[model samples]
Target: MKGLPAGLPSLREVLSRHGLDARKSLGQHFLLDPVLLGRIVAQAGDLDGRHVVEVGPGPGGLTRALLATSAETVTAIEIDSRAVLAIEELRQAVNGAEGDRLRLIEDDAMRLDLASLVPEPRQIVANLPYNVGTPLLIGWLRQAASWERLTLMFQMEVAERIAAAPGADAYGRLAVLAQWTCRADLLMRIPPGAFLPPPKVFSAVVGLIPHPVQPPPDLFRSMERLTAAAFGQRRKMLRGSLKSVGGEALLDRAGIDPQRRAETLSVEEFDRLAQLL
Candidate 1:
């Protein structure tokens, strides 16, 4: 199969040369298969002239694949010092037309001010660390206008939640927020053995197309609080669960049944509850 060009070291070679292993505390699971890496980039769609932001690029396996594409610039954020060192060669190898196309930052992606690094018309594509994936996604959702698409990988359960329907088992806080602000799709499921130190659960990639129809600022806050309350006590009926947030009166005002459980409420109903709150 075609893979990363001949100039840069293979991902396995980079790990070996640097004497590094995936760090569990950092949620590191290095993807060693370049073929899989190519496939993952392919899922990001045509990258020609588009800027991409990648998080947790361990050993640059997926990073190499992304750079191989036509993407104009790729800002890769990584937390591991050893892994950052490992990417130095890859960075130097990117010369000529790919000049400065790869910006490797050693920092926590969760804390990074995304606007500072990400240029307009960006897409987030990553083999995201299991620990901070959801928070990172939520942060991106808040700045969704700056991004074109979010083709992100997450634990299968988390991916399920992001793309889940109101009645599905995985649907909850993340789902409501994701579906409300973006059109989400579950692209594919990946087996555990694809990575160096394979994760226990399978992983999945989800693509989110951002929409401009988000709730107004205060209403968005209300939606978050309302989802937290409803799903916080999911088994309880809306009237009992939402007591602190106006409970039955809020339910009456929204014209939603007080007896309906949180899990059963559609995104529109959730929005109504948020608006009423």
Candidate 2:
């Protein structure tokens, strides 16, 4: 078959050429499927004139697709030096027009302050490293208003949790936090075979558009603490589990039944409880 381009190699060729083997330690599972990558980029709605931030651009697979989109600029953050070298060709392929728009930052995404780095109207499009995905996502959600949207790929289980409804079994701390500040949905599922050194579990792409209005600032923090305590002992009733915060009185004040389990509560209920606390 044909290759990607003369300098810009296909995912397989890049992996073979650079000894860029997937490192389990880095949560590196390189996605090689162009179709799936294109779908993920498209789900970001309209990237035109928007600044796109991508994390862990492993071998520039998703990066290439992002560059091909309508985004005004694509700033890719990658910690792996090897991947940095691979993306150079991607930068070249774009040439002056779109290519000049690509900025490859060799740094740990966890340490970067996204809001300060990229100008307003930013959207993050990434196939995140599994090890840091949840923590990174939580950090971003804490500052949800900074970005226009987020198009991310995560393990299917994680994606389900992000898009889970109040009463569903998948609903928990993630669902509460994600939904409280953003409108989230599972866009599509990508099979294990789509990746080089495919992960054992299936993965899915999720889209999150930040809510225009966020919950009260203090209430957001309080809700996080409350949920952490309540779900820490998830099997117990809220009355028992929440005693560390304000006991049954808090639940009573929120008009929530103390007998209800944490998993059964809605995001609004959590917000009310936080307000009461």
Which window of 10 residues has the lowest lDDT sum in candidate 2? 1-10
Backbone clash count for every predicted candidate, in the order shown:
0, 0
* Candidate 1: count of backbone clashes, pairs at least 3 residues apart or interchain: 0
What is the overall TM-score of model 2 with all chains considered together? 0.94
Error of 2 at 268 (Å): 0.7
lDDT for each candidate structure: 0.85, 0.86
Residue pairs with backbone atoms closer than 3 Å in model 1 (clashes): none
TM of each candidate vs. truth = 0.95, 0.94
